[model samples]
Target chain A: MKELERVGLPTVHVCTIVPISQTVGANRIVPSVAIPHPLGDPTKPLEEEKAIRRRLLLKALEALQADIEEQTIFGN
Target chain B: MTYRVVHYINQFFAGIGGEERADYPPELREGVVGPGQALQAALGEEAVVVATLVCGDDYFAEHAEEAVDKIIGLLESYRPDALVAGPAFNAGRYGMACGALCDAVSKKLCIPVVTAMYPENPAVEIYRKDLYIVETSDSARGMRDAIPKMARLILKQLNGEPLGRPEEEGYIERGIRVNIFRDRIGAERAVDMLIKKLKGEDFATEYPMPSFDRVPPAPAIQNIREAKIALVTSGGIVPKGNPDRIEASSATKYGEYSIAGLENLTPETHETVHGGYDPTYANDDPDRVLPLDVARELEKEGAFGSLHDKYYATVGNGTPVAYAKKFGEEIAKKLKEADVDGVILTST
Candidate 1:
């Protein structure tokens, strides 16, 4: 978060809900599926869930590569 | 000359009511309520709270256009010298509403729109440049203290006075860069600075180093089969029983914990103690914050040769800039020793 960015760690964050909580210190943010299960809801069948998880994982990777200022949220 | 000031507030602050009163649409009233009263008192005869507008959080968030239109219509008639809103403290919804309104008014009417909030409030980043935001306490208890500071800033804006630093002015640091002139001649100062540098005396840099804008893309892996990747984070993820004990805010240290043979983060094994959010979910399942699960999947897919056995972790909250840079350099040195080709970092 703030400490990491302050120390110049080149960090990015991913969360299922709005990470307003993290923005004070975080350099970047990527929206995820949910709080308890960020990759995908475990209630769904494993195969369907993995597909969603894979997609979000790719989005998180993209967030790390993207240059940003202040705080930015990826994946809308 | 008397300057007219328009005050903006949420339903509760406007005295129109709370959640129940939130449905109340935007309307203009004369004078002030809540912190606006303190603003009026502080600004004194120089400024008058000519109008007050109130709207519900749900109303503004859901029906932004309609609410803004109504509020703007009211403001247009008042023709205020400046607009002031909440030192919203830590209320996210209200802080956002204040930021939105201030941005709109400043852009549309070309009037100075000012508000305040706690540094922790998310609105500081969203609207710090668009408005004059003074830092306040996390609750209304800071009203008496926050209001006077905000009013003083508004007064300075009205008088066309140059603003001092955030610390001096009691505002949240906007991190805006501005060229400032010194009273002393530049040539003399330059010579003095050079002498200090040669003598190894600590001299403040005349020009602060520009922030690095373009990070070189991690060189494309020449061979994914042989390249090693590392997991790093500022998300405050750590092992159970809080072994490393990283400081929560303004962390001076970082920890690199061994994750050998761990395919995934489990609630029982890993936890997050970061103060920024409710760690209930992330603590119960560290992968939600660290994404070790995703890293394992990437390893299985042969995206890289191997995941480094140990991953670096730290608390990113309120960390100072100088220390962060040093930490990154140190971590980079470690990565080099381990032949780490790339890093996939996650944050909360």
Candidate 2:
């Protein structure tokens, strides 16, 4: 994500560990739900997981489009 | 038998004129001078200051190589057991001179070298790994405390005693990792640390995470609705047969798979090879990690311009930061060539 951002490409990191993402210096970050299934929670039903993934991806898109001078975590 | 020691200091510390005398050439004098008196007293009977080398900060800075060579030549005749440089505090030039002189003496003279400076001194970052630098206060006020630590550390070197950890020894961390046998396995240790953390007790991490360079954010996509987006992942998602053979841990290479005309990642088409986490959920539906299905939904909904046909993937598990950075740069180059306007990078 930092590399992409370096080359003038807007990037958002969807990560389970926000601190790790911050330390790695990602410009934009969206917190994922879990390590095993970052986009979809395993315990949730298939439809629910897809809905959660959609919500998270939407948040990621929001991050990519937002202007930020420093590292910013969207949706905590 | 007393161990012979050599001390190095800047002109100001040698009681020479401050700033105006900063151009004084390197000079060697017998016995302790200035702060060396305190350092010698700290050494007690175990060590004796046999010589002092004083150089102007400007002269050393301007002619570092020559100054170090001259200083080394002057000290070689004394054949001191160890060399000690200044407790330079926050003075940048003096701190650098001390650090450089110590480093040169340790290398060329092949003897133990010790220096002292404030932790925040720029020289600390440059020389901490190569030299033992006792932490000092930001100014000369730290002299009283710094000399003893510097003396003790040098004495440890002279006696060939094993050094303690940086915190225990009052020195800056060298950023070196040493392998040691522990009574408990890593899992048990982690659990113990977690419990301590939960109880709000202080517990040092076995491995401190390395910090990375921060890049200023690029401008936001002005028209994300008309942007060309790409997906990149460190979740180790790949084709059914693992054609690239990327390592499950410490991935050396990244794969760019064609997602062209694909609606979503199915178990028949994709699986995750990442070893850091349980792969069950991702194996069941690779989209759980990559989110191609939702991305397609958004694309069809005209939420963005379009998704790039190729998505990059690599395993983040235990990957060395250097390789990860290289892969990121290469992948970014490809994405740029493909005119990708934005990226959504997922990591496990």
Candidate 3:
């Protein structure tokens, strides 16, 4: 991500709930609820999971399109 | 025989007051405050807390240079042999203030500085290298243990003795790199390790692992509506039946699947065979792993010019750093060819 960013390509990261990426310097991050299933709760109904995934994904896309000067957190 | 020491504390710890007193500018007072007594007691007769300075967290953060200058001015008169700040524990702002102070003191005064905080504190990365940082619990409950370690490190600096590793000294790992002479070759050690592995014998690793220095975040994209965005992942989602046959683990290759006019990813058309873990969820409905449904929705919302017709995928677990870099560059080239202005990379 850093390399791509250096070359002038915009990049937003979708990461797990873990805080590791925040420390490693990902400026735009959207936190997935868990490690194995980042977009939705695996235990929920398939349709319900799909709804959650769509919301988070839209937020992530919005984050990429938005202008930011410093590190920004998107959907938590 | 006495070694003079300088103590740094926030307004609350300095005994000036609480949140209301947080604006208390940097003031130097002779003698110790609360924890300074415990620190002095631990330092014994060899070290004395000669001067103490207190400032508010908000004030210091808002006026870092002014605070540092004021504190440095006060320290010039005392010239302590060492500086010790907070065992800030879980207080984010206080921990950061202590780190900032330690870094400033070491750079300006050219004296050893030490402090302690929990590993989770955000300040660990800020000043771990500028000073000796002893690891402490989330609260002051471990002060008895943390202070003794700080005192020992301070004493070592005063006596010019070699400082040991964090594990040996019971301090927090400062994440500083130092070269040390080793007794044997890593290859030979690896062979021996392999032999031990075959024999199931316990053996120490010859080459210790290095720490990771994370890069700072990059600036965000300016225009989503005008930008052509691409989707990338290490989740290993690919065309049905794994057409590209990308490896499930330690992948040496990556695959890109087209979604030119696709509104959703059905299991019949897309599936994930990543071997890192069970792919039951991803295989049932590829949209669970790849957000094509959402991407199409956003496209309708005019959030971007268009999601790239194709999205890139790879299995990241255990993939060598070199290969991962190569794969990223290759995929980036593809995206560039398609005039992608930005990327949203999903990691699983």
Candidate 4:
């Protein structure tokens, strides 16, 4: 993500481990669901899981569209 | 029993000449040369400075590969058990030569190699990971102090003795983690640290975070409706069978899959090879890791302009920072050429 940002391409990282993302110098971050399944929750119904993933991606997209001065993790 | 040691020094150190003779070509001499006398005295009778390899700083810097090859060739005949390079002080070129020479000797000749330089020496950043470099003062005035530490370290290495921490051994920290047993359990230690922290007392962390490279945030996407966004992942999501064969851990390569027509990732169409986590969750539904399903949905709903046809994937489990940076640069270059305006990098 740092490389992408260096090359003028705005990037956002979606991951469960926000501290690591911050450490790696990610400029824009959005927390994901969990480690094994970052987007979908197996316990949820297919539709609900899809909703969860869509919400997360929307947050990631928002991060890309929104300017940040420093490493910022979009609150869940 | 006597241990044989080879010493490397720059043109300035050999008393041949200073800046003018910085172009001196590599030369091999019979025994102790200049500073080697001091090193010999420090090594005592246990180790003998078998020979000295001298080279001009400019010559070595300009022709590094050849210089290393030539020096290693000269060193092979000596059959030295260990090698010592100058306490280069703060001389950038000299420190570089010593670091490079020591690095090559240790690798090619399988000998213990040691050098000393000021902590701020530019070469320390480049070669500290590969050499045992004792910290030194900025000038020859510290030679007396530096030589003994260098000798002790090389001797310890030659004897196969366990080395203490960098502070105790008088060497710059190499940032390498060594596992050692502690009397107190981790929870107890954590509590102790917490109490110290709450009391404003000093405490050291067991694991120190390495400094990282920071990049200024790029300007926000101005035209979200027309931006060409790309998806990149360190989640190890790839086509079934992993055609690129990216390692399950410590991946050396990344896979670029054509998601041109793919609306979603199914277990049959995609799977994850990341070894850091249980694959059952990811393999059962790769979209859980890559999120292409929801991404496609957003694209269809006109939430964004378009998704790039090609998506990059690599396993992040235990991958080296150097390789990860390399992969990121390459991937970003291709994305830029493809006119990708933004990216969503998913990590698992």
Measured by DockQ, the strongest candidate is 4
Deviation (Å) of B50 in candidate 2: 2.3
* Clash totals for all candidate models: 10, 0, 2, 0
Model 2: DockQ score: 0.79
Give the number of colliding residue pairs in candidate 1: 10
Q: Which candidate order results from sorting by DockQ in descending order?
A: 4, 2, 3, 1
Off by over 4 Å in 4: B1-6, B15-20, B28-41, B44-52, B72-81, B89-92, B106-111, B118-130, B137-144, B157-162, B173-181
Candidate 4 residue-wise lDDT, B1-348, digit = tens: 899999999999999999999999999998999999999999998999999999999999999999999998888888899999998999999999999999988888888999999999999999998889999999999999999999999999989999999989999999888888999999999999999999999999987777898999999998888889999999999999999999999999998889999898988999998999988989989889888888888998889999999999999999998899999999999999999999999889
lDDT of 3 by residue, A15-69 (tens): 7844655655567888885655677677899789878987787788777666777
TM-score of each: 0.48, 0.73, 0.52, 0.87
Ranking of all candidate structures by their TM-score, best first = 4, 2, 3, 1
lDDT of 1 by residue, B135-253 (tens): 99999999998888888888898889989988789987676877878899999999999999999998976566434333322323455556566778777888887787888788888
Assign candidate 2 its CAPRI class: medium
Candidate 2, residues B66-154: lDDT per residue as tens digits?
A: 99999988998998989999989999999999999999888888899999999889999899989999999999998999999999999
lDDT of 4 by residue, A8-56 (tens): 9999999999999988899999999999899889999989999999999
Error of 3 at B149 (Å): 0.6
Inter-residue clash pairs, candidate 3: A65-B224, B135-B172
Per-residue lDDT tens digits for candidate 3, residues B16-114, read 788898888888889898789999999999999998877888888889888888888889999788999888887888888889888888898889888
